[model samples]
Target: MSTLLKPEAVNRPSMAAQAAESVVIVMAGADQLPVRRKGGAKPVSVDLLAALVEAALPDGFGGVSRIGFETAWEAMAPETRRALTDDLTCYLGWSASEKRQAFPADPEDLVRYLRWLEQGRGFRPATLTRRIASISRIHRMLSLSSRDTLPTRAAMVADALKAARRRRGSQQRQAAGVRLGPMMNPQDEVEGVTLAMLFSVCTSDLQGLRDGALLAVAFESGLRVSELAAIHIRDVDPQADGRGILTIGKTKTDQEGEGRYAWLSVDTMRRIGAWLEASGLEDGPLFRRVGVDRRQGRPARAPQDYFSIPGHTRHWQERLQGRPAEPPLARYAIGEGPLTRQGIGVIYKRLVRAVIDEGMVELEPGREGDLVRAISTHSMRVGLTQDLFASGEDGAGVCQAIGWRSVSTALRYVRKQSVKGGAVSRVMDGLRR
Candidate 1:
């Protein structure tokens, strides 16, 4: 597990500060449940814990949830907190390893780290900006000289951020559009890959059924991969009219868990049903990793991985290092657990590329190669958003359909698509008048 030794190598408090005493800050490891290191009159000081928390937490715009401090830390998902901790720890290690300065990196050295991350490490400008904020928080909690506050080098962090922007430009302003193309005709292989073409090739088999259902549902819902992976079978309720409602139990937008619903088409509902029937899953996660036993016949049921979530008893990463003989799953059995966020994207990419190789996607003359690399798990969501805009659906209405908390986000998608088709660009097209 990634850890930043408290400045001065101070030991961590045995327990966390009580609610009455102070705010809770989680310091969970990959292989264990979060041990509450409460602050009191103890060997480990509260100041050390504060440094660790400050190092791990996000303080920049839209970093933390908009919810109040009452349960905000608790509301911050363990996975998210863990990720921040890892990022912060990695940065500190780099600072020391490079001999830039001491553990609490000096301002002059931080500037070097920024440049190195961009040019040497190949981190984007946006990521560089976030890292600077994290570094700033570290200095605040550790009571060290801050790049932002030091009078001699005040605006040093700002200068780094400005340099980052100059290097790569604004990331949010770039959202590529996905346009529909000819659907796959089984006999005649389609060359250009379209969302419809890709979905059509995924048949009603074990893996195909799951991929088809997920693609269709994602297209209709426009959910992030995390939201899609979090979906449980119980959350889906089919309506008598063929359309179904999907209750997103949790999301980045609805951090409070005041669940929202997104409508799915009858087609998507049917695809989901097909997968469910084939998998023999009564309940639990709807999307799961496919069993890759590669055995001859259908095998016995594999045991459910109960201790496989946050504090996984047998964390995959650790297991890999030791090199176990047998594979994770002995036989082919669908999991009762949800798919990992990374798995969703991996599956989507694999399926799309599979169809592309099979000549199922018809493309324009030379764009086939570029198109394959471009389509992401989000292609379905982006395509749907673009389609909605082209079909004249208003921003507010689209937001409601897609379960977006704000119409502003939906507007960005619309605006992005609009710019591609903007009249101003067309006037200067070909020969100028």
Candidate 2:
């Protein structure tokens, strides 16, 4: 029994040790790990580059992806590539919002998205159309064919857009009627003078200067507040022989595409000169807040200081003292750069309030009369157009002066004189005679 047990147990521990050693040696024979470069940075992938391009777009709602898709689609058509590129550049430059976090997953989502943009963002009809067009372009690009109908789900959306546009046109017509609001009462032409007087009576400080200049320019040049606010020092050549040319870079219809040069009248030139001289403005934002000290009110410092940012304050102060500073003449009077739509509204409201307070224009409650009840900044443009038409200026002349690309847009501003007591019927009776 002892002999049998000893034979069975022979080399069992040695055999197990040999098996473990073989396994270890096999594991060690596997592929060696790769070595990293000493100094070279890892290159970004194409997918990442595409995503980065998408991220760089300024307009909200995956504008970059839309643009990328458009470009990729355009590559198939050599003729359209140039136009597409130009359009993309313009779109990116004008868009105010950053690219959206996500894109619409479905066509219905796109429709809803557009509606949200219109309602929440108060996108103008033109702007809404542009965004829809962009989305349509993206869809076409993704489908890899121009023949595809704009997302079927967007049909209702399209109808809604059309309806909204029609409604907007109707509302604009009604608003234009309100804006025209009866000819300056035959006897109330004196109201213009009264309005001017009201502005004069407000105060003779910086605020007053701004108010006066604004009114003078608005009345004389028939400029919208947008035009007024956008007037740069360089835009006005004071040495142009008693009449300065205003190079309007942008307007409600033009969007700063091709600038229109309009002649400024003598009175407007004088008022602008007065405002500039009194405010000591040579360059930069033309209009700025007049700082009020505890003792001195609206000091006649350079208008440049009024618009300087906090970081540039010290530099401006030094420049003001006639000392050398970084970016010379950084503290000169520069007019307000561009007036936002909201800012134009606010400025008009304030102007109307000032006019009403002074009793210059009678804004009778509930009586829609020739007197302006609630004038908006756009009223200036419309009013001026009406005045020009009434004075016998043609559509082409008005279009040229106001920076309108289309005659139809100018026609919107030119209202037909309202004939009283069925003039058409009377003409028909004459025909019978």
Q: What is the TM-score of each candidate against the true structure?
A: 0.65, 0.53
The 10 consecutive residues of candidate 2 with the worst lDDT sum are 1-10
Tens-digit lDDT track of model 2 for 1-433: 0100111211122554433332110111112312223542233333443454364433654344455654565343322333344333333433324333223324565556566666776765666666666555544544523544555335777776776687565334222311323344342122232344435454544445565556556654556555666677677765434656666675555543476666766666666666666566667645443322222122233334544446646566644554322221111122234434344555555555565566655555754333334455566666666655555577788767765567787666543442211357447756876
lDDT of the candidates, in the order given: 0.60, 0.49
| lDDT assessment of candidate 2 | 0.49
Task: Give me the overall lDDT of model 1.
Answer: 0.60
Best candidate (score: lDDT): 1
Clash numbers, per candidate = 16, 12
Question: What's the lDDT for residue 366 in model 2?
Answer: 53
TM-score of candidate 2 versus the correct structure, residues matched by position: 0.53
